[model samples]
Target: MLQIKDLQARVEDKEILKGINLEIKPGEVHAIMGPNGSGKSTLASVLAGHPGFEVTGGQVLFEGQDLLDLKPEERAREGLFLAFQYPVEIPGVSNMTFLKTALEEIRAHNGLPAFSAKEFMKLLREKQDLVEFNTSLVNRSVNEGFSGGEKKRNEILQLAMLNPKLAILDETDSGLDIDALRIVAGGVNKLRSSENAFLVITHYQRLLDYIVPDVVHILSGGKIIKSGPKELALELEEKGYDWLREVETTE
Candidate 1:
């Protein structure tokens, strides 16, 4: 559903991603694990068309369209969703209002009509049940006063509601307790389908146990050094990144 070729991205004058190449098929989940400052999160940011990052080279194709050509909102309109590791709080925007606006925009882009408040709430409740998202937060400002778990769950709640074709979750496991992690994983698993794909960026192998990956890629020094099944994650967790790097250097 998504393919990136020789992806190179920079923040300001400092380049972060160097020649990243990955392809994700629908119904597949790919976990990207890397040491700190290895450009893992940069890849996610670049894919989502974040304005702060510049594409120095390469192309990203979302179902055949050049993703770099689209604006961030346009990327979202084209069925790309990126759940940020750090969700920003919009003090003036109510959670329900923010979601409704996004839903309407996406619906329009997809040639669907806007939802009435009742219809929107009905859809929201259904999605909430799917993700087990709490209803109390819906009326509050987006991300305002949300606990770490709540922020992550709200992100997944949006995912469940939008039903994007491809979802890029950058560091979804960060700051989450075991219970929260399971809840987040459950929400993501519920959304998995033949027409959707997931790019899960994480540091620990524990998250992999909850959301099994079709492929595990070890990214280090800005490139993928090892690619294998879920067993690769276990190997890394057991042996540490130092061993993985040593093995990569030998290869």
Candidate 2:
């Protein structure tokens, strides 16, 4: 569903991603594991069309369309979702209102009519049940007073509502305890289907225990250095990333 070729991006004259070439097809779950400053989040941000980063070279095609050419909102409307490592809080905007506006916007993009209030409430309840999201949280402002796990769950709830073609979860496991991790991962796993794909970016293997990626990639020095099966995550957990770094330097 997504193809990236030699993707290079920079922020404020400092390049982060260097020649990132990867393809994620429908029904596949790919995990990207890397050390600090390895450009994992940068890849996610660039793919999501975050304005803070500028693409210097290479091309990204989403279902044969030029993804880099689209604006961030355009990317979202095109069915690309990025679950941030830190979900921002909008104190005045209730979660329900935020989700309704986003969902309607997406529907409008797809040439569908907006949902009526009753239809929206029904849809919200269904998605909440799908993610096991607390109804009370929906009444509050987005992530305003939520705990770390709650914020992550809220992201998953958004994911369920949007039903994006490709979901890029940037360190969704960060700051989550074991239970919260399981809840978030479970929600993601439940949403997996043959028509959608996932790009899971994480540093540790614990999250993989729940999500079980179809492929695991080792990213280092601003590029993906190794790609392997799910067992690769176990190997990385056992051996760590130093061995990969050494191999990269020597090669």
Candidate 3:
């Protein structure tokens, strides 16, 4: 569903992603593992059209449309979702109101009719059940006063509600305990189908144990250096990113 070619991006003249080339097809889950400063999150931000980073070169096509040409909101309307490593707290906006506004905007973008309040509440309840999200949290301000795990679960709840075509989870496992990780991963697994894809960016293999990827890619020096099956994550866990660095140097 997403194709990236020779993707290069920079922030304030400091280059982050040098040349990234990757493709994620529907029904496939791809995991990107890399060391610090390896540009894993940069890829996610660029795909989400974060204005802080500027694309220096290359092209990204999402289902044949020029993704780089779209604004961040446009990207979201186009069915691209990015789960941030740190979910920000909006103290005044209740989670329910935020989600309702977001869903309405997306529906309007797709030329679909708006959901009635009753219909929206039913849909929200169903998705909350799907994610095992706490209904009490929905009535409160978004992410405000929530624990780290609760924040991550809220992100998954948003993902479940959006039903994006391609979900890019950037360090979703960060700060999450084992139980929270399982809950978040379970929600993601339930949402997986033949028509959607996932790009999971993580620094460790522990997350992969729950969300088994179809392919594991080693992203280093702002590029994907190697791609392999799920077992590759086990190998990386056993051996480390140094081996991949050595391989890159040799090549």
TM-score of each: 0.98, 0.98, 0.98
lDDT of 2 by residue, 118-204 (tens): 999998898898667899999999999999989999999999999999999999999998988988998899999999999999999
RMSD over all Cα atoms, model 3: 0.8
lDDT of 3 by residue, 1-251 (tens): 89999999999989999999999999999999999899999999999999899999999999999999999999999999999999999999999999999999999999999999999999999999876789999999999999999999999999998889999999999999898899899999999999999999999999999999999999998989989999999999889888887779887
Model 1: per-residue Cα lDDT over 113-199, one tens digit each: 898889998989998886567888998999999999999999999998888999999999999999999999988998999999999
Could you tell me the C-alpha RMSD of candidate 2 in Å? 0.9
- True-vs-predicted CA distance for residue 208, candidate 2, Å: 0.6
Q: What TM-score would candidate 1 get against the native?
A: 0.98
Model 3 C-alpha lDDT versus the unseen true structure: 0.94
Clashing pairs in 3: none
Per-residue lDDT, model 2, residue 56, is 96
What C-alpha lDDT do the candidate models reach, one value each?
A: 0.91, 0.94, 0.94
lDDT of 1 at 156: 93
Positional deviation of residue 146's Cα in model 2 after best superposition, in angstroms = 1.0
Q: Flag regions of model 2 displaced more than 4 Å.
A: none
Give the Å error, residue 43, model 1. 0.8
